[model samples]
Target: MISVEGILFAAALFCCALATAGYLISLLVRRVALAKISTWILAAGFMLLTLNLLVAAVHWTGWSSFGSRHFLSIYAWVIAGIYLGLQLKTKTRLLGAFIAPFILLFLIAAAGQGADRNLVPSQWQGGLTTLHLVLAIAGEALFVLASAAGAMLLIQNNLLKNKKPGPLGRLLPSLGDLDQINHFGLLWGFPLLTLGMIGGAVYAAFVWGGSWPADPKVVWSFAVWVFYGFLLHQRLAIGWKGSRMAVLSCLGLIVFLLSALGIRFCLATVHNFI
Candidate 1:
């Protein structure tokens, strides 16, 4: 028998899948109305996931019971939330065609994990750790959005460049709006990630002392920070935008994913909780 939590998760996943299909169809068929309906469907999935998380938190007796499953779920939730929030300021509804699949993928990954498993050890559970995770996840989620926008920008640029926009071109967002979304992601994400790293560092100092800096996860995270910092600097200072920035954002995300996977599976670090 499936539990209520399970059912809720399943429903949320189903909603996300439907939203993904709706968004794709909207793009292919050039139907703005379908895109609007897909946005509502994605919003429904977000709400259901919120409820599922609340139920899990109550069942586990605290927010500290987060495992890999919960982490992925929250990650997906943040992505959806941020994207929906961006919709208010930008006409990027069709971009949902690119974003919804990622949400679905994360939810699917969450479904594959054991819901009862707690990734954070008892010793590491506290307010600071929770803050660190939340901030870091939000930052990463923004990066995901930035990459998606960048990907769409590339498509839009190519179509415009070739003078072959056709119906598909009409379905995409403006390059300026897509660039602004990328800018928003980098402008906000970098600082949040930096603060999150600071919080983690403080926690680590109290727990692991000097040796924590040498941990593989810490090293990889710092490298990621520096890479993004450079990207941000280039965007603000060097005035990089359009295709160059778009390509870099997408490539940066790819590198981030590869390095993260390598660190998680092949490394021996104290930060393997998630």
Candidate 2:
């Protein structure tokens, strides 16, 4: 018999898939009705995913044994939760076209059947670990939204520049709104990410002997941090905006994601807590 957590997980997966389809249909058809329906469907999916996580936590002693799989699940939950929160604040319903695909990707990743074979030592299972992962994943979720907004801005700008305002372009948020979301993401995400890095470094030094700077994952994380730092500097100091900023934001997100995903598998890293 399927457990309650398993049942909830399956339902959450189905809801996310349907929610993604609803958002995509709304984008292609430019139908306000479909967009509204998609919004509710996504909300339902988010709630179900949340419950699934909660139930799992109850069984596993509340994140004390979290591994790569739990990180992926929490990452997906944060992304979806942030998107829903942004929808309440902004007119970004159409932005779901970009956000939903990521939600689906994360959900699929979370569904992997791998159990935690390398749980951290019991002595290392408290506040710092929780704080580091939570802050880091939350910051990444914001970056994901920022990148999606940037992509929309670029698409909208291209249509305007070429005098080809297609039906899809008509549905996107205004350039100003998209830029605001990007700005919000950067303003908050950078500090959280920095703190997370600091927390991780402290935890590592406390647990292991050194800071593990030679680790490839640490190097990649620093690179990602520097890339976002440069983008923020460009935006605030040089007053970069519109297409240029959009392009950079999207590019930075790709680099951030690649460093997180690709570097983990491609290189030998001590941070592989899987």
lDDT of 1 by residue, 196-274 (tens): 9999999999988777888888898898899899999999999999989999989888888888889889999877755
Model 2, span 1-274: residue lDDT tens: 6778778877888888898899899988888678778888888988998998888788786444565666777888898998899999997898887998898898787777453544455677778978888899898888888889999999999888899887767788888999998888887888899999999889888777775788888888888888888888888898988888789889988887777677668887766653
Candidate 1 deviant stretches above 4 angstroms: none
The candidate that achieves the highest TM-score relative to the unseen native structure: 1
The global Cα lDDT (0 to 1) of model 2 is 0.82
Candidate lDDT values, in order: 0.90, 0.82
Q: Itemize residue pairs with steric clashes in candidate 2.
A: none
